[model samples]
Target: MQSRRKLRFRLIVSFALFGFGLSALFAFAALNIRTRVEDQLVNASLMDDAKWANQQAREHPGAPSGSRLLTGTVLSDRTLYKAPLTWQSLENGVHDIFEPGPDGEEHHYKLAVYREGGIISFLQYDVSREELGKQQLLFSVIGAVFLFGLLSLAIGLWLSRKVLKPVSELANRLRDFRKAGKAEPLAPHFADDEVGELAHALDEYSARLTAMVERDREFNSDVSHELRTPLAVIASTTELLQGSPDLTEKLSERLKRIERASRQATELIEALLLLSRAERRGPTRGETTEVGKVAADVIESQRPQMRGKPLSIELAVNAPVSVNAPASVLSVALTNLIGNAIKYTLEGSVRVEVGDGRIEVIDTGPGIKPEDAERLFQRGVRGEGAGGSGAGLGLAIVRRLCELYGWDVSMRPRTDANGAIASIRFS
Candidate 1:
């Protein structure tokens, strides 16, 4: 594909070629006019010379009373003329005279002499006026060609810009839609050309894309709703098994494991449901919610999960750090991030820092490898240190929620610390 600069250069070259073609046509017309004018002048000069020769023949005495012709020549120097000569050996029709003048000037003349009786006559005429007029015409043609060429160049530029304006606007709109991840359709302008066809096509494409996205959102929401029932039954069954008293010690231990697995599965299902909901809820409805308050609530709610673990919690939120997003969605996202930090950290603390339009969750567990950072938020991909206890959907859900709220998320190894730090910045 050609770059924009190359395309523009080609457009300019095309206009230049068009202008050159027009100039060539004008030059051809001028040349034709000059040739016709020269031909007419030559014919007129010949006729005038013939008339003078006939008149002189009538006035001349019967030197032979035959059709003898006298001819004269005018040279290139206007004041020079050759002596008249009677030619008896000439043909009876027309004859030409070539001679030198007084100043060695050279000229040519055609003489036509005829007679019924013996007669001699001469005709002298100058052909310089025709030559001079031809020179003037040639010079005028050259000047007009140059002037028209410049005029065509200017007009060509204006015409090119006028033709390319709609194309440029379409390109700009496509670029903006790609970068912003949403389309703003251009206002319609009607024309009976290819540009009009292109505009109609683009409008149809944007409409189809918008419809497809809306359908996908609706499908996700429906799927999430359908899965919730089964998840809830599994959670209730596991809880009932853990609470039953008829179980043996070993079986009770197994039941406790089942309960834990069921709880984790329930949390994973709930996270998926929340993620689907977040995706469907567009950004326009987000409200200002305090990040620090959400952080504190998540930490308090998850305190029971960290009962026997030697993990510390640190909150460094000083000022009111708020974000324009759904409070419930933000709470779920932050809870997942903090929970992942705690689950990954073996012994050290999990730190939650909140600032204006920013949140950071850092853990002092074994840091994630550089290669794994890219897929950390991808579904079903977990760090090497994450055991079978995690469903690997927590970070994915967090990332999805952040995206829905127009937030940027970055995860990397904490260089100054010992574990990974997940940062979220609100837009």
Candidate 2:
């Protein structure tokens, strides 16, 4: 079977991903806005510095030392003022560039250039401190993004658990209901939401299922009770008819068959009733019966069926075996085992072995199919090679009876003999 991912894990991952995406989007927006605002502020500061320098240079044209300006005559091809290597690249406008300061520290500068009377003037404004502040703003935004992402992840986890707690509790309650055969009210503790609706639905389903189970048990009990009355009457009437002595041989045989059939029917009814009772109230204690005697009686009762075929049924007792179970249950289970043996075997004998707390029926019939062994005792299931006129309920009934009395039953193909062995071990 393919494994499934848990709902809680999916919920957590989905919420976490949503949080991460939202955090990344906000961080990107913040970084873009901070970059734009810092650029505008730097441009304004550089323009103000350029205007101030121009005013100073105009006021004191000859003494240019008071103002931070480099004035040079570009009419001749010679250097006239202190300039960097790339100073020629400056145009007649403000430009931001990087240059080395006196201490060799990297500095950001705004270079403003103007030309008049064959002379070129350049104004340089140091903006490295403002650049450092911009860098700090970038770092702070990055740090905020990281922190917010973590916070979002934490919040997602918390919310996911809060949302999935009711689901987990419902699962646990359902498990408890299965074990104890009862369901507790779930909507009382949860809020009025989707989870609460689900719990309420489950409560309704549980009620319906419990009612169906109760009705089924009652139906089976009532049917079994109704069946016993007629079966008892038939058994008593058959006994009375069998006691009559003025009958012919043919009539006597027919009556004997009727008596056997009636007794078998009555025993089946009793077994069914016992099985039904066991279902409702569990296994009940009964008389301790000798396993050997039970096996002998089963064989004797099956003798009539074996007469037509070349089959012999024998019972052997290794030790005085006994079990605490109803006599009818033991009889029905053994009868079904021996009957199957007799019905399937064409020419070989069927042996019944009784030991302490154990009974085994070894039949010289066609060995059971390996595939059928797994569900051999399931109701209405017949093996592929089972050549019989049965509805396949005998072994099922035997299984139910064994379960009722705390007995273990198993069936397997015999290795030494071309047949099968069915065993019941009592505890």
Candidate 3:
């Protein structure tokens, strides 16, 4: 994957490339213009000098002399025959010529030929000096292009810092708010600009979010408080009824079920309250709960759910396991895990193992897909065979409880059996 470049760095590179391209373009045009103009002027001067020398020779009828940079030759009927065959039929225009000089090296020159009145004239001008000047001009333009690019880069850096200063300040302020777990009015700290508008929007969002969280906290508290009152009454009433004498065996068993349900509801409320607050409920000072005892209790509470299915629930205490949390918290977590196992298993056994600072509930039931192991823990998600009455929040609540207390919970399909294994590692 390609990594993203920051906006500030992009701007700097754009400036540098634009400067280099424009400078190169201008240099190219200037060089073309200079070369064309110099050639035109040189051609005109050569042609005019050739014509003048021809006329002077015609009027005076004598040989002419020339300077080091220029030479003119007037050829008449008699002298034309002495000229080389190549020069005899030359046209009347500027033509480039290369000839061997006294040093046996090639020399470059421009020949302007003129013909009129039985006389042809040639003016030759050396252009090697002009070529040297063109080379120097090309080097100078190249240097200027690089210089302009560097200057543009410097300017871009300075402008970028100034332009992004407000944005950086806003980001820093938002970071501070996050660390402090509270938000302040961002607009008050910024000037009236785009950044300030952004800050105002963030402030509004933070206010709405805070208000919504406060309402949720209050709602959970109110619900838990009201629910506890009725649950307490039911528990107290059941206890009183249990003290009655002359109770039949069947009646006593029914009462025990009611009592167990009432206590389960109370524990469920406590767990839900803890989840709502997203806080840990540590065991009381100098207290710890044994994992095996909690697991056995949770299994017994959930066994009533089998409803006469050909399913058996078993608990295996592999080793002495304990955790630094209230039994109610552990009960809530284990209840959900073991309850799901027993509910899903149709005819086979559900085994609960407590050891090694963890508990594993393995059941022979309709196994889960490996891909959906984590998804099952999400709220509003249900397994394939889930009953219509299920809200799918059991595993979600369990996951939340585990996270609150720094426990690790996971579900996976059993390798040797057609069922699932769920484990919670308390570390």
* Per-model lDDT: 0.69, 0.75, 0.86
The C-alpha stretches of model 1 lying farther than 4 A from their native spots are 1-13, 17-148, 154-211, 227-290, 300-310, 314-317, 355-357, 368-384, 388-396, 406-408
lDDT per residue as tens, model 2, 1-427: 9889888777777777776778778877887887788778756655554555555555566654323343222211244345565776566666877878878988877766654443455566777876687788778877877787777778778987898888888788779877986678877878899999998997898789778978978987788778878877877887787788887788878777777777777778778877765742322565477778877877777888877788888788988987766566788899998888888888888999888778899988897976677597998887544465778899999998888778899899998978989999988
Ranking by TM-score: 3, 2, 1
The residue-by-residue lDDT of candidate 3 on 1-427, one tens digit each, is 9999987899888878888899889999999999999999998888888777667667767556342337767788777987767778889888888887667878778988888877788777878778888999999999998898889889888988888889889999999999998889999998999999999999999999999989989998999899989988988887888888988888877888888888888888888888877878778896889999988888777777897799888899999898988888888888889988887888889999888888999999998999999999999988876353588998998999888999999999999979999999999
Over the full model, what C-alpha lDDT does candidate 2 score relative to the true structure?
0.75
Q: Count backbone clashes in candidate 1.
A: 5
Candidate 3 residue pairs in backbone clash: none
Q: Which of the two, 1 or 2, has more TM-score? A: 2
Off by over 4 Å in 3: 32-69, 72-126, 386-389
- Per-residue CA lDDT of model 1 for 1-427, tens digit only, reads 9556655556667777676777778877877887778657655555456555555445653322222223442221222233243544454445556666556888655555333334333344445555677678778777776777777677767776887878887788789889998777554654757876887888888899789878978886777667767767876887787788787888876666665555555555555665654543422455577889878877866665676789899899856777766566777787788887887787879989988768999999888888888798899877777444676877887888777768888889988978999888878
Quote model 2's TM-score. Answer: 0.66
Cα deviation of 214, candidate 3, in Å: 1.3
